[model samples]
Target: MSQKPTSSENIVNQKYDRCLADLLVKTGVGFSIGVVASVIAFRRRAWPVAFTTGIGSGIAWADCDRLFNPTRGPGVRIVSQAQTPESK
Candidate 1:
């Protein structure tokens, strides 16, 4: 029988799944836009496809980084519970 995963493990798995989904969606959108832009604006050049794809991948990477390390992300703050005198 397989044991159930711990809370921390579940959280990690959820984050991973979310990251993967984000990457796929973002990259696919970028690729589609790139294809359109290549055909219309860039004279069917291959560079636009590559450049947009890279931009999409970079955005996904940043999002994943922020998700995995919330404290390290910009404008993020962690607040601890205030201790009362009675608890001290």
Candidate 2:
């Protein structure tokens, strides 16, 4: 039989959900900007500018998520310290 999740697991799950929501928001903002920029560039007949702007927007959006998330990405770390016999 499967055991129920503990409090720590619940906290981790909540953090993951929050992070996912934040990422979704970031993605939406980036996609919206990309669409607007692409439309303007297309109207101006600037195909290269439109293409690059769309790609860059997507990349920047993902980067924001990676840079800001503390529970995931490069932010995960562990620290350890040794105790002297006297201290113990």
Candidate 3:
């Protein structure tokens, strides 16, 4: 029988899944935009423009992946603690 996964393992799995989803979304958007730009460039006879744009967009896509999928500890942190006024 397989042993149950520990809480830490579960958290890591969740982070991996979230990271994967983020990457997929970023990549999908980048590809769709690149395809449309290519079509337009072809119509306009601007092959060089399309090539440069594709390169720039690829860099942006990687940046998005890095921005959203942080490798640092489980991204949870308390921003503030509520405080109550002195008891009446």
Best prediction by TM-score: 1
The candidate maximizing lDDT is: 1
lDDT of 1 by residue, 22-59 (tens): 99998988898999999999999999999888899899
lDDT of 3: 0.61
TM-score per candidate, chains pooled:
0.77, 0.46, 0.45
How many angstroms is residue 32 displaced in model 1 relative to the true structure, after the best TM-score fit?
0.7
Which regions of candidate 3 fall more than 4 Å away from where they truly are? 1-6, 42-88
Candidate 1 vs candidate 2: the TM-score winner is: 1
By descending lDDT, how would the candidates be arranged? 1, 2, 3
Give the range of the ten consecutive residues with the poorest summed lDDT in model 3.
72-81
- Judged by whole-model lDDT over C-alpha atoms, candidate 1 comes out at 0.90
Which pairs clash inside model 1?
A: none
Candidate 2 residue-wise lDDT, 1-88, digit = tens: 9987679777768766766676666556655665676677556455545565556557655665665564566657655565434463
Which candidate, 1 or 2, would have the higher lDDT against the true structure? 1
Residue 77, candidate 2: C-alpha displacement in angstroms? 9.1
Higher-lDDT candidate of 2 and 3: 2
lDDT of 3 by residue, 2-32 (tens): 9986797777787668666766665566556
